[model samples]
Structures are given as structure tokens and as C-alpha cells.
Target: MKTFIAVLTIFLLSLQCDRFQFGSNQTKDDQAGAVVTFLQGNIFITTQGKESKAKIGDVIRPGDRIITKLGRVDLQTYRGEVIRIKDNSDVLFRDIAGASRQNTDIHLWTGNLLVKSVKLKSGQNLSVTSPTMVAGVRGTVFSFELEKGSVPKVKVYEGAVSVAFKTSPKLIELNEGLSKENYTRLVKTLEENEVVLEPGEKLEVNPNLNELVYLINAKVATGALTGDELSGFVDFENGLSKVNAIVSPQEKAEVETLVSIPGETIQKQIDSQNADNTDVTTQTIEKEHSEKRIEALNRIASEAEKTGLDNEEEIHSHYSVLETIHKANGEVLSGAVVAQLGDIFIVHSTKGVFQLSVDDIEYVEYRNFKVKTRAKR
Candidate 1:
């Protein structure tokens, strides 16, 4: 009887050891990415049927769903890519770290997200999947914005990106000077749908029509279009051939006046005057013109913001100069303000979306008004 009891105890001990080993392996397999940083409002993470509030220095495992409400979260993957998820956005970590053989895959459900990748080693990859399109990238800086009813928009900043539609087998390049004809051809061609995007190019993918539309409207907002192009594209009488019910004649005039004064030219004139000790009368006149130009720009920005606010459901339809960050070293960066996390301001410039440290910023110029940083309490 004693011998039989001892043998049964040994068997039970062996089973316990096996269970311990299995639990250790399960924990290792469930490991995911981590939250490197975050700022303002509520950021929640739901994983494995459990929901919890996320904070800085928290570990985010694979299969985790991150939801941001009135805040932003910056997450870093094992491969050293930083993803900044903006306010009112939902993203799922479909694959991260050891979850998949591939590098990383993120799914953006709604709102905007900016991705900045470190130089990748050979065979490393990062892909962002949206409702309509999938962007495969390597060592690139880019942004993805999505709305419920409209299509998804992707903009590249530094590196090139290849975007493909979920339904179509083709991919399209969004390189510089992609002509309207080539764009149309790609839309029509099924096999040659893939496009590479260069810096400063933005494209929107329409899943419903299986079409890609280059946002030429961006050129209008940035004052890059010539008078003829503007008149042709936006003028009610001869351009779009359709009347713009939203833009009043006075507003059109204001836009024209603001674009007429080149910001670069004004800066150059001011520099030259200061260097040559120009007459006070000439300097004063130039300064007055610059001030007036700034005022006009502010008015336009305000009107655009107000319009967007009034039509919140159609906010994506209105493109406006969101804000300008002036660096202490005299560099001016402009674009839509994606988010402000602590002392860092993320701005989507023509080059790409950049994170500007508040410590390095002299001030922010929005709608022609100068705003200095507030002192920390």
C-alpha cells in the first residue's frame, strides 16, 4: 500500500511540472509590443477579452485593440517603428513582434495615424491596412486618414510607399508629376494598378469605384496652383464648369489675395532690407504689406476652420491650412495639425508628418496670429 501511494504521488508531481512548463510557453507566446509614449485624454487597450486603461510604459500584446478618445498614443514596435494614433481613432495590432513571421501589420479602422520607421534591415517590412487599401512600406514616414463613407487617403513624407487596393490585385505608384492620363490609365488597368508615392504626394483610394483620385485640391490649398490652373479647376464660370455653392465671391477674392503674396518673397525682401540698411519709408511699406498678407491668410484659415466645424460630418471635404510651427532656427513647417502630445506637436507638412518638440519651437502661427507656448504649472 505504501509503495503504491508513493508511485501515485510521483505521477501527480510529474503532471504539475508539465503544467508549469505549458504556462511559461503560453506567456511567452502572448508577448506583444509596448507603449512608448502617450498624451491627454483616454486611451484604452482591449486584449484577450480583458479591457484596461493604457498609460506610458505599458506593454501592448499582439491581438490588442487600441482605442483613442480625445487623445493620442505613440506605440513602438520591436522593429523600432513608431506609430502615432490620433484622436478618435481605432487601431488593431493584427501582428506584432513574434506574432507573425512578417515584421508588422496594423489595421486602422477610423481617423488618422502617422508612422515613422527606422532604417530597416534586410527583409524587414511594415504594412498598414485600412478598410479600402493596404500600404506596404519600409523606412518611410507617412500618414493615413479615413472617414466612414468616403475613401481612405495616404500621404508620404520622406520615403516611397506602395499602395494596393484590397479588392484589386494591382498596385499604383504615387510618384511626383504623375500625370492625369497615367492616373486614369492605372485606374482603368487592372494589372498595373500599383503606384509608388514620392514625397509631398497625396492619393485617395475609392474602394466603391475601385479608383484612385490624386488630391489636386491640395495644390489649391497650398497656393501651388497658377492663376490659370486655379481658374480652370475652381472658377465657377470657366474652371470646374460647376458653381461652388460653398465659396462666396468675397471668399474667393480673399483666397486670391492671400495666394498672390508669396511668403518666401516677403521673407527675402525683409532680409535684404535689413542687410542693406534700406530707407525707413521703403521698409515700413514692405512690413505693412507683409502684415496685411498675414492678416488675410488668418481670415481665410478662420473661415475654413469655422466651415469645417459647422459641417463636422463633411470635415474631410474642407482642406485648410491648419497651423504653422516656427522653429527656433527660423524653419517654418506647415500642414494640418494632427495632434499635440505634451510638448511635442505633430504637423503634416509638405515633406511629411513631423514631430516638433515644443522646446525647439519659437512659437506657432495659426491663421496669421502668433501664439506663444504657455508656461507649465
Candidate 2:
């Protein structure tokens, strides 16, 4: 009888393990949204205020939050779409195959995500929202990151993505009357809504742009400004404040006409002014360029700047194989290729950060690095 009891106990343990591995209430329909395919390190799923360690084959529905502390996790949605949540990330599934919704919404409170999305069926959408910006994609492979103390960025590898600031001006606030021509222009600006990023394009929304909107709104409330010129000010501020794209001295001089402070003062404020409050533009030539890259590229650039290009032979010895992307149309992009997610390559060039697909490129020369730390995502 002891031998029979031992076999029965082992069978019961197997059933209990299945019950714990996959959630107890999982159904076939639950797999339509988020189903964990792979997990490493400390991954947790919080549902209804309770947290449990995540396991492979666990189905996470709407209103669930995935928190990664020391590792990474891969979630599979319907149609084989994969979303990789990198380490030190916090993401929430706001809407995923809900009863009344056709879109799958992933809201990243903090950290990085690499998304490989499949073409949606009719009337379906996929959106990712960070604190500063929102990206709407129909079918695309993309990377969206919200790193601390840095601007939120979106890079599209394949297909297209429409991106816009969360604080973009709303049309409902245009209460004042205007000419038909002016009204048409204002509506057009607001309706454009977001920047449509094609394949090989990337965008970064400056955190300061939201502050400028607040300043504009305050001025409008005091009756110092009117509705007719609001769009121009917003468009101008958006264009200049974005990183990687340089803002000229002439444009900086013109901004004083729109706001109380000089454009230099605004830029100074964005940089959080040195303790001495001396003008940054006059001190560092690098600050004037308005060029921003991911930390990896910044590291390479900083080392090069410290050891002038005259010492190229010494510098090239430390680094092997600078990354260069050659497009099929004969255009060339050179930068530090930071991260590779499947066929998508995220390149940080002097011009800006670009996410390009292997399909769009004729060939690529890249380096393999041994580093102590990597850029988040």
C-alpha cells in the first residue's frame, strides 16, 4: 500500500504545478491578448493589487501590470506579435482584446520596449504611450524607450508610426472668433495631430515642449495672447525644442518676439543653467550644436572629443569596426549601432537616432562590443 500511495502523491503534485504555472482561471479567450512566451529573472505580474511571479504560458489580460526588476520578459499577443519588455521596466496593459475595444494599448510608465508587430486585421490598432509621447502603429517593428532624465524616443524599423506629444494643443480651447482663412489654418494644424514616421525615421519629443505649452496657456488665460497666433507659436516651439535638430541663432533671436524671455534664456532654462548662470552657448561649442544621441553614441563621441581626431590611430585601436549602414538607394548612414532586436537595427548617427530594417539596407558593417553596462533597451 505504501508503493501505491507514493505514485498517487507524485501525480497530485504535477496537477498542482500546472495550476500554479498558468493562472487557475485561464481560458482559451484569454490567450487573445497577452500570453507570456519567455521570462528571465525577477518578473512579476500584478492583478487586482496582488503580485505573483510570472511564468511561461501565463495569460495576462487587460488591467494587468508587468513589472521587471532585474531581468526581461517576452509577451506574445495574437497573430504571433511579440513585445519584449527590457530590464528595469514597468508596463501596463490598458486595453487588450477587451469586449468593446479593437485596439491593444500598452502603456509604459517607465523603461524600454522592443515591439515586433504583425499587420492587424480590419479595424484593429496597436498603440504605445510614454509619459511624453504617444505612438500609434498599424503594423510595424519599432522601439520606444522612456529613459530617466532623457527625452522619450520612438524609432520605426518597418511600416509607419504616427507620434505626437501628449500635451499637444487642443482645438476645443480656441474659443475666440477668427477669419475663415485663419480658422482653416488652425484646424489643419491641430488635425495633423501627430508626426507620421516612415520606415528608417525616428523622433524624440523634448520634455521642455510640455513646459512651453503650459507657459503659453498661462499667457492665454491672462488675455495677453489670442487664439489666432497660437498655432504658429506652438509649431515654432515644437520645431526648435526637439533634440538632434539644430536651432539657428536667427531663429533664437526671433523667439523673443513671441515670448517675454529671450530664446537664449529659454534654452538656458532647458539646460537647468549652471550655478554661475553664465550663458551655456558661449562656454561650450558642443552645447550649441543641439545634437543628442543615445548614451552609447555619446560615449564614443565624448572619447573622440577628448582625444582629438589627430590621434585617430590610437583611438581606432581601442574600437573595432565602426558601424555603417548602406541603403539600397546608395545613401550611407554612419553611427554606433547600439541594439539589435531581430532584423531591426537601432543606429545613433550624428544626424539623429534611426531604426532601420535589414530589408531596406544593401549591407551593414557593425562592431561587437564587450562593455560593463549597456544602454537601457
Candidate 3:
């Protein structure tokens, strides 16, 4: 009984510092153009006084739904954000930040949400967190899952996110917008439209893929790929050696691939098999560059900064990576090689990167993953 009371007390107290406030007068009639569409599950649209409770496993899609948990609730204001609330999940909404940028705040008790948003602007983001995780978005679309665990997982579907509270600053990560499967479909559709893929191929959008794979696949599909581009992919094996010494041989191979992993995944394999690495230097550099894997990481971060939490963990966690390569001291790597560095991107042009460390770095520039500690608190 004591524990139950404590839990309830915490939820009640959350309203104190909560920032998302919905106005009662901004009802459906006030916002005549705002339309709510239930693409999948039954979603209830209510006003401030109308909504009070919601259960877990409940799905809300493409529509206006009055929430009732008491602090904040998020909406896909651009009408592009897709969100889902699981059973026993209670949420509350007060007001949207502004119409120009589409910043919305949401608070969830216990469940899940899948969100897809149109590109938003600065200060037009979302702030949400459970006991395990916290996410801040700028103007991207994605999904979030909260359950009882050591840490909750945040997944991005369309845009990018910066997620904190998982570990260190690197845990202040970048996530992607589309799933690998979706990316593949995107590629197929592009190919089909360009008369390149098999006839009748459709754009495939999967919710289960990590955003990185999705972006890569999408680039491969929509972005023009010439013989030289295909050759770059073929250069994988040789380029594979450059990052070897800094990362585990197995890890080096697994980390850079464009393979697709499904949604509902906990990234256990990626987590458990993180090379049992104790090389702090490699870990630091790796974590930093993870977001700088390429320019796209920056683009995602640039867009996410619009949300107040751009510096937070939830959004960018889904959209980043680092690419390091080594060549003979004098050999110049191709632009393609340099482009691989996404966030805190780096290239060890020094002799044998295998024998390098942060100390060896001539200089460093931290990008999407800032060196400062916004997470420790």
C-alpha cells in the first residue's frame, strides 16, 4: 500500500514542473481546420474537460484527441506526426507552443507511442520522459515506447532525435526517420518510378527499422547512384580495414552495414555485443563520431534543434553514426570516404589508424553529440 501511494504521488507531483499546457477554449470549433483522422485504432477526440483517462495498448492516429494525464500531450500538428498510446497509459495536453513551428509537449504515464511529424522548427519540439528515458525533438517524426524497465527505448521513423539518460554524452544520440525495410521500399519505389527496380515495386515503410538504415537505404534508392557509387559500396571490403583497429574486427563489420533490423527490437544484440570494449579512447571517439557518420546526421540534428529539447536525448538517438578510415600517411582518401563521417566525423589520415587514439587526433570537433554534459543531471 505504501508503494502504491508513493507511485500515485509521483504522478500527481509531475504536474508541478510540467510545461505542456492546453487551453480549454482551443477546442475543435476554435480550430475549425484541424481535422482528426483515425488511420488505425479507435482514437477519442476530446476537449480539456472531456478527456481524463486512457488505457495501455490504445492506438491514436492522424487526428485531434483530447488527452488527460495532466501535464502535456503531443500531437502531430503538421498532421504528419503519428503517435500511439499503449494500455494503462494516461496523458494530458494543455496548449501547443505555436502554429508556425508546431511545438507540442506531452506527458505519458505508462505505455507506448509511435509519432510521425512533419519537419518542425526551433522551439517547436516535444519534451517527454519516463523513469528510464527522455526525448526532445525539433521537427521530425518518429515513435517512442515506455514500459517498466531500466531504460525505455525511443525510435525515430522519419526525422532525427537526440536522446539522453541512457549512458554518457554519446547516449545523447541520433536516430533515423525511416526503417530499413521502409528504406528498401523507398528505394524500390524510386527505382520503379525511374524504371530501375522491378516493375510494380512499391514504397515500403516499416516501423521496426532503425533510422540510420532507413536513411542509407533511402539515399541509395532516391539519390542517384552511378557506377562510381556502386563501386563505393564495393569498396566496403577494403574500406573495412581502415576502421578495424579502432573497433573490434567483428564489430567493425557489423556497425557499418545497411542491414535492416525490425521495430519492437530492444537493440539487445547491438547492446550486448558492443565489443566488450574497454578502450575508453576508442569509445569516446566512436560515440562522438557516431552522429557524424555523414552529413545526413547533421541535417537531422539541424532540423531537430527547432524543438527546445534539441540538446536532449530522445530525438537524436535515432539518427547518427561515425565513420573512421585510415590510409598510408600520404595517401588521400576519396571524398566518399570523408563523407562517411556523420556527426563528430573524423578520418585518421595518420599512418595506420589501427595504432591511433584520441591523443593522436590532430584536433576534434564535436557536432550533434556535444562534449558538454546535459545528461548527468
Candidate RMSDs in Å, in order, are 24.7, 24.8, 26.2
- Tens-digit lDDT string for candidate 2 (55-118): 6546577789999998887765544456889889999887664223466778888898877666
Q: For model 3, give the RMSD to the true fold.
A: 26.2
Which regions of candidate 1 are displaced past 4 Å?
Answer: 1-32, 98-101, 168-188, 210-339, 343-377
Question: Model 1, range 187-259, lDDT digits (tens) per residue?
Answer: 3332334567766676644342332222332343454544333222211111001111233323243222221
What TM-scores do the predictions have?
Answer: 0.47, 0.48, 0.29
For candidate 2, list the clashing residue pairs, or say none: none
lDDT of 3 by residue, 268-337 (tens): 2122223443233334323332333333334433333333332223222322332233333533321111
Best by lDDT: 2
Candidate achieving higher lDDT, 1 or 2: 2
Ranking by lDDT: 2, 1, 3
Candidate lDDT values, in order: 0.53, 0.54, 0.32
Flag regions of model 3 displaced more than 4 Å: 1-34, 39-46, 52-75, 78-80, 86-88, 97-102, 165-377
Candidate 3 lDDT: 0.32
